[model samples]
Target: MPKVKRALAVEDLTKIAMYSDPQIAPNEDTYAFVSATVNDDNEYQSQLFLQKINGGEPKQWTFTNAKNSHPRFSPDGKKLVFQSTRSGLSQLWIVPTNGGEAQQLTFFKNGAVNPEWSKDGKYLVFTASLKENDDVGNQHEQTKEERQKEKEQQAKEPIVIDRLKHKSDAHGFHDDKRAQLVLYDVEKATFTQLTVNDTDHGFEDISPDGNLILFSANLDDDADYALTNDLFMLNLATKDVTKLTDGNGSYGNARFSPSGDKIACFGHEYAYSGATLNELYVFDVATKERTCLSSKVDMQLGDVMVGDSRMGYSTEGPVWSLAEDKLFFIGSDHGTTGLYQADLKGNIEVLYKDNNHVFGFSYNGVDNTFILGISTPTNPCNFYQWKNTELTQLTNANAELLEEVSLSEPETITITAEDGSEIQGWLLHPYDFKEDKKYPFVLEIHGGPHAMYGQTFFHELQLLAAKGYVVLYTNPRGSHGYGQEFVNACRENYGNGDYTDLMSAVDYALENYDFIDNDRLGVTGGSYGGFMTNWIVGHTNRFKAAVTQRSICNWLSFYGVSDIGYFFTEWELGKNLLDDPAKLWDFSPLKYAENVETPLLIVHGEQDLRCPIEQGEQLFITLKHLKKEVAFVRFPGANHELSRSGNPEMRIARLNHICGWFEKYL
Candidate 1:
C-alpha cells in the first residue's frame, strides 16, 4: 500500500525544522550551521550542527535547549564561537570544532553578541551593552538574587523619554545602557573597551592586521533625528577614532579588503527617503575617497525577499576575493535573491541565481565554494553546496514531515494595471482542487510597502491553501524586487497606484482562473498589507470578508502613536502632522470607514511598537460606534513581529483566527 498524505495543519510548524547561517570553516571542506524547531512547550529551540562539505553526516555540536546561533569559525579552524541564551541571557561561547566541551567566553551584565575573530586568533571582539559609568570586564553576569532586585527597582521607576527614538520593536523602552565594543584577550583573559559613547555602536568587522576596528554609528548629539549612519574606525592600541564616510548616507556591513587598504560597504543617500535602493560602495582607506561600485546595477544589494521561515541572520557581504580585486554579495531582483560578483571597475556579473529563495550563504575564497541556505514554496528551508559551477543539495531538514503532508505550490502570475504597467504575483490552488467546483479565494498582501513577496515558503499562505482557499499574494507597485521607479510609485501616492494594482491582481485572477469563486472573496494583510485590507473594504464592497492585522486606521493618531510615525509618515507620505495633516488623513483608511459593508476582523499585537495596538483599537471602536460589522482580537505581550517570531502558541492562535474568520463569512 502507498503512504497516505494529509493536508498541512497549523501545528505542523513544530515538526518542521528551519536551517540558517551556514558558515564554511577555514579548512574549506567543513561547515557549520544552525537548525531550529519548536519544542513540546511551544518554544523555538535551536542548536549548532557541524558537517563536511565533501561528504558526511551532520553532527549535533550543541545540546542546549536555548538558541545557539551566529556561529563563526576561528582563523585556524580550530574552534567555533556562537551566541546562546543557555547561560540565561545571550552570551558568547566557544567550543573546539574537532569535538570537545564548550566554554563560556563572556559574562557581561547585559550579555554579549556579534562575535568576530581577530586574524591571529588571540583576540575576540564582540559587542555588549554598558552603562555610562560601567566598566567593561568588571560588570559580570548578575546572580539571580541581584537580577530580581534590579528588576524590582526598574519596575518601580517611571520611563522618562528624552529622545525622538526612545523605543523600538525589539527592545521596548530605551534604557541608559548603550551598545559598545570590547576586546577579549584569549591568552591573558583580560578585556579591553574599544568604544565609549552614549549612542549605540554597530560592530562591522576587524581589520586583517587587528589594529583598527570598523564600526557604524551616528555620533551626532541629535542622532535621534539623524537618518544617516557613518562608518568609523577605532585604533585598538592608540584608542583614536577615525571617521570614514561623509555624513551624507547610511552605510553598514563594511568589510576591509585583504590588505586593509580598501573598505567595501552597502548604503544609500536618502534621496527618496526609506524607499531608496541600497548601493555598493568602496572607500579608499588612505585618501578617504569613496566610489559607488554598483552605480549601474539597478537592484537592491541585499536579501529583500520577505519570508517568515528564516530565523537567524547571515552576513551578506562585500566578501573580498583572495586577490582583493573582486567582491561578492547578495542582490534582490525580479522576485528572486541571488549572489552577484563585482570588480573594482564597477563591472558586475551573476554568480548564482534560481527560482528558489537564497536566504543566507557563506563563501570560501580559497577554492571558490559557497554554502547556501535556500527555501522554496514546497520546502521550508534546506542547505545547498555550490562548487565550481554545479549545485548540490546538502540537507533535507523537513524531508520526513514533508513526505507525510501535502503542500500547495504557487504558480507565477502577471497582472496588467489600468495604466498598462505590470504587477507580479503568485497564485496557489486549494489542496485537492477540482475544475468543476468553484473554491473561495483569499487575497494576501505583504507589508513593507517597500518589501517583496517572492518564492520563499510562507506558512500562513500555505495554511489558507490547505484549508480549501485559493490564495493569491502579489508584489504591488511599492514592493521591492521591481526597479526603483516601480517601488517608488506608491510613495506619497498611497491608495492610488498600489490600491489599483492589488484590485487588478484580484480581477486578473478571477478572469484567468475559472476555479475561483467571485461571490465568496476574502482579503487579509499585515502592517502595510493590513492598512490596505482596511482600505479595500472601505473603498469597495468586492471582498465579502476582510482580516486586517497590525493595521493602521487613523493617520492623525498614528503620526503620534507609532514608533516610526515621526519620520516614516513624512518619508513615505511626503507629509507630516505639522506640515499637512489633511493630506495624511486623506490617505488614511479611517476617513472612509463609513463606507465599509464587509464583515471585518481586526487583529493586532498589544506590545507592538511599530504599528501600535491603538491603531487597531481606534478602528474597532469607530466601526462599533457606527454600528458596522466588526470584531477585534488582540494578542497580549505580542509585538509587530508576532506573526513571524512571537510566541509559538500565539502564532498558531493567530493563524486559527484568520482561517476561522474566512470560514464564517467567505
Candidate 2:
C-alpha cells in the first residue's frame, strides 16, 4: 500500500519564506526580489536576493535580516538601492553590486520609503511623513535624544484633533503628520520638498525628460470629506505645478508614457462608491483629454487575488509597451490574476493567465523578458522569469518544505444567488478524502468587501482541510474581479445581498456534495468577513459553531472608533451615523445579537486599529450578558493582519484556538 504524505500544518506554513517586490536590473539579465520568513523573534525577517534570468541559484544580496525592500537597480547596474530599518528608522541605503557595504543616504526625522530612481539616475524621489509644524530642512540636524525629549513633552499634552481624517490603519492617529513628495539629488546630496499640502502626496512616475515629477493629491480644503484625488505634475526646473485631473473621480497609480506624450492612470468616478470597479485611463499630454481605455473590458483593472504578503498593493501602471503603441498591466478575472496588455484603441488581451496569483511582476520591455511573483493553492510564492511561453523558476523558497506536506486544491464552483445573480466560489475537500464518508465542513469568508479570494495559498484554510474538514470560500458581491454591476449590487445593502449570496453558496455545496455532513457545519471570517460571521450567527442558526475575528458589531460605534471610520462609514453605509442612527443600527450585527443560538468564538487583535478590539469586546460582552454560549480570545500586540503577517507564535496560536473551538463544537 502507498503511504499518504503529511498534511499541511500550521508549523509548516510558519516556516515558508514569503516573496515579494521583484526588481529587474538595467542589464536586463538579472533581477532582485525580497524573501521574508518568521524569525526567532516571532517577527518577520526580510532580505533581498539577486538572481539571473538565464539560470542560477539565487544569491542573497542583503543580510540585514531587517525590513529590507523596495529594491531599485541603477541604470548602470553598478549599484542597488533599497530601503531598510537597520538604522533604527527606515532609511535609504545603497550598495555596489560588485561588493560593498550599504551606505545610509538620508537622516530625516521621519525616515524615507518607496524611493524611485530617476531616468538619469541622478535623483531619487521618495515619500516621508512630516509633522504639521516640523521643519524638513532642519530635521536632520536634530539629535535623537532631543527628539525624544520633545516627544515626551508632547505625550503629556492633549491631542487636539482638527482634521477629518486624523487616523488610518497604517498611520495611527495621523498625529497631524502628512506624507509629502521629496526629491533627493544623488550628486548634490540634498533633499528638496516639492509639495506643501497638509495631506499626503503620492509619488508616481518621473517624466522621461527628468524635468518633471508626477503625483496625486487632494489639496482641497474639504479634501477629507470628498474621496477624490487629482493628478499634478511638478516642474523641477521652475518649481511650478499643473493639475491634470478634474477631481470628479478618484485618480491614482499615475504613470507617464514613454514619449511623454500621454499619461496612463487608474480610478473610477465613484459611480458605485466603494464597489466601483477600477478603470484604466489615459491622458493626452498635449490635448489634456482623458479617455477610459478599459471601458470595453468588463473586468476590474487591478490585481485582487488575496494572499499573505505585506508588499503593498500590486496595481501597477497601465505601463506603456516598448513600442509606445500599447500598454501592459495586471487585471483579475473569475479567480485568476493575469498580465494583460492594452492598445491605444481600448483593446486589451491577456498575455498570461492561469489559476494562480501574480502578486507582483517586473518586465524589461527592451528585452521582452519578465520576472513574476506567483503562487498557487499548493505554492507559497516565488519569482519566475517569463521568457517566451516558458516560465523558469528562479527562487524555490518553499520547494523543500512543501515537498513533505500535502495541500488541498480548490474545485471552482458557481451558484445562483436569490437575486438570480451568479456567485463564484471554491470548495476544498478534506486531505484524506473518502467520497462515501461524511466530513465536517467550514464556510470561510474574506475581508475587504473589495478584495477577491482566489487560487492562492491561504495557510489557515489549508490547515483546516488537513484536520479533516471540507472548506468553502467565495467572492460574494462588493468584491472585485466581478463586473461593475455585480460589485455595486452590495452597496448600502451589505448583509442582505452578500449574506444571501454566501447562504446560497452553502446551500449549493450541501446539496451537491454527498460527503459533507450538513449537521456538523461551522463558519468563520475576519474584518468584513468577521462582520458577516457575526451577522450570520445572529440571523440564522444553520451552523453549529462560528468564529468572528476583528469584526464589526455596531456601525454606530464603528463610525467613531475604526481608523477610517468617519469617511468609510459615509462611503459604505450611504449615510453618516448621526444622519440615520436607526439605519446603521438596523444593519449592525449587535442589534440582532439576541437572536443568536449557535456557539460563537470572538477573536481579535489588541493592536488592530482598523476594526479595533472594542468591536470584539462589545459583541462578546453582549453575548455573555444574554447568557449565550460565547467565548472571547484576544492576542496581545497583534493587529488586523494577525492571520497573514503577524507574529509567528501568535498566528499559530490563533489558528490553534480556532481549530480547537471548531473541534469542540462541530
Q: Given candidate 2, what's the lDDT at residue 348?
A: 89
The CA-based lDDT of model 1 is what?
0.90
Q: Which ten residues in a row have the lowest lDDT in candidate 2?
A: 308-317
Clashing pairs in 1: none
Candidate 2, lDDT over the whole model:
0.85
Q: Backbone collision count in every prediction?
A: 0, 0
Top-lDDT candidate index: 1
Please, what are the lDDT tens digits per residue for candidate 1 over residues 1-666?
Answer: 987678889988668788888999998888999998888888999999998887888888888889899999999999999999998889999998878899998899999998999998989999999989888868689877888899999999888998888989899988899998889998998898888888899999899998999999999877888878999999888889899977888999899998999999999998889999999999998998999999887888899988777787876777888889999998888788888889999999988999978888898888888888888889998888888878998887898989988888889999999899999999999988889999999999999989989888888888899999999999999999888888889999989899999999999999999989899999999999999999999999999999999999888888888889999999889999999989999999999989999999999999999999999998999899999999999999999999889999999899999999999998
List runs of model 1 lying over 4 Å from the truth: none
Candidate 2 per-residue lDDT over residues 316-405, each given as its tens digit: 557777778888788988888878888989988987788898777887889677777788988878878887877878877777877788
Best-fitting candidate, measured by TM-score?
A: 1
